[model samples]
Target: MSSSLHSPWQRHVPQIQRKHQHWLTDTGSLTQKLKNHCEQFVVQRVRQNRAFLNLSETKSLCLPLGRRILQRQVLLICDDSPVVFAHTVTALERAGRDWPFFNQLGNRALGLTLFANPLVCRSDFEYTRICAQDALYQIAQTALHTHHFKVNLPRHIWARRCLFQHVRHQNSRMMVTELMLPEIYQLEKTSKAR
Candidate 1:
């Protein structure tokens, strides 16, 4: 049985999706540059010969080899895959080394494993540093802003906080697979009321 009823904007959804896809692909170079910048920060800070970084569609930080990697120094930061984040932690702990590299990382080394996905584990902690995004400071600048009836600011902000909060609690791991569509069905009515 067909679950969906005929929707007026069924045709428009595809167009909107195409636009977003185009935007990401067009900015692919810039995204790569951004990822490179993030890597540079870690490389510059850690003076380790054996360092491995993982980049995937879902963005996850992972340890290259499980038990074999115990002797080497590895730091993982997975933006597209939180599963990598969880696994890295588990592997590191299993390796059972305090890892001198942690001295170089300092506080930056404390938190990096994300638990929200449940796929990531604390054992990867030896090689993975769990860190949470500074959502409040990141949004505090525009905490109070002009209203855009087309976009509900309150709900948007709340959702962002919720996601950030949940991820932080789980070792700052976040994998945004889908866009959070704004509930602006009443946008026209809200705009008219104003």
Candidate 2:
């Protein structure tokens, strides 16, 4: 029941279900994998604003002394049901120069752009459990309410994160965190029953 977002992100969480671990460790394109999970996969953009990221995020992205960064949050919806919550942070100063398409990705998955670039290199995946008090969990709840999704999310969720860095300018990179929402398991169950 750890409520801190600063909880260490590990390579694996042995206590979670094997199914949950499957999704967390998949290094392939998440946007593509999600497309196969439902008839329709959509990226619902929740918020994209300038703000200071939490300490963990700031350090992961290697941002300068508490500088403002671009924070974008989205819910990956499958057949109208939200399945995953995603948060991304890029230094506002270098965003356009480094992550040129980040600001233009309206409802499109950021994974699409990241995976397509040959100049970008991704680091290893790190796993984390997000409890109710964590900002990420709170954002997921708010997204559910705002979108009027009837699904009841759990008090905690499992999320994985990694950094996408520019091969040319190593310091210019973005950190992406994705949380598998509870409804995702429901969808998996229903799909298996079919």
Candidate 3:
């Protein structure tokens, strides 16, 4: 007789579905697809800005392989916002598998940024622990943690999505999107090239 639906969990259905969608989207997209998009977007932007690199555009950047390259170096940019509720390390691992070169080049430098720093939080602790177990390149966080590789976490922008609109200031954004990672690397290359 009432206007309510028969479903018991209907009230939370939207939220549950949203989370599932996010997971599926992130997991379904491959790293190469992300990297390719990033390359095109970043290159176009750089060209417009008069700061483009002269790398071999024809040659596809084949990512390295195995533990040798894996131990070479890596820089992980994590926008560790509580609202971005998804498995962080697990997702990164999948990305690595998807793009062996991207992960191998980093060797193991993992960088993290939280939207809001939390003290004694279980999520924070677990994130750190999982990253360590993964043999990350290096783990840096805003929160105090006793690690041999701790460094001053850099400024980063956080957003609900990785699109340009969702991104804030480029100079201070975390840029956690898998596609954007290569763009970040390209920028670093440009800086060095300059």
Candidate 4:
């Protein structure tokens, strides 16, 4: 189930825990899954801004260097607890023309929109274990700090990303990433104990 995505010297690939594997491997709407699991599921928009794409992002979206994109961050809240941190990016021009709702979708689950739309097609999932040195993880850590939502991070966090393309619009490419927060593990443990 594990293929070498990074170079050998980059650090041995982290093993996926059994509990997390089911969640991570599910390709269906994560928003729905969270809703089904919790009594109350909410989407809290954390950040939505225009910024230059990172190297990994630029490559994923097949965009040239120095191109700016609309970046969004959201926390998936289950039973008033933040269980997942989601990040997404789309080209600036495509944000309006292709995804007209991107700007207007405040506190709405992006997964629902993408999955419900008939025009959108998702790519295979790509996963990575993020640690202190990962830029994206650092960004998430800083955001959680400023928001005052205290959640301690484990040594590594599992993250998955995929590209969603609009069948009608050739250039309509969007990359969505979701990170499993430590709170998610706690949530599962608590539910099982009940």
TM-score of each: 0.17, 0.90, 0.19, 0.87
Q: Rank the candidates by TM-score, best first.
A: 2, 4, 3, 1
**Taking the candidates one at a time, how many backbone clashes does each contain?**
25, 0, 19, 0
**1 or 3, greater by TM-score:** 3
| Top of the candidates by TM-score | 2
Please report how far candidate 3 places residue 179 from its true position, in Å: 14
Is 1 or 3 the stronger prediction by lDDT?
A: 1
Error of 1 at 37 (Å): 23
Q: For model 2, how does the per-residue alpha-carbon lDDT over 67-180 read when each residue is reduced to its tens digit?
A: 788989999998888889898988888898988888899999999889999999999999877777787787778888998987666777888899999999978988899888
- TM-score pick, better of 1 and 4: 4
Q: What's the lDDT for all of these models?
A: 0.23, 0.81, 0.21, 0.79
Residue 88 CA error for candidate 2 (Å)?
0.4
**Model 2, residue pairs in steric clash:** none
Give the runs in model 2 whose Cα sits over 4 Å from its true position. 1-6, 188-194
Write model 3 residue lDDT over 79-106, tens digit each, in one string. 2111111112211232344323333322
The TM-score, computed over Cα atoms with residue i paired to residue i, of candidate 2 is: 0.90
User: Which whole-number lDDT from 0 to 100 does residue 156 have in model 4?
Assistant: 74
How far out, in Å, is residue 106 in model 4?
A: 0.8
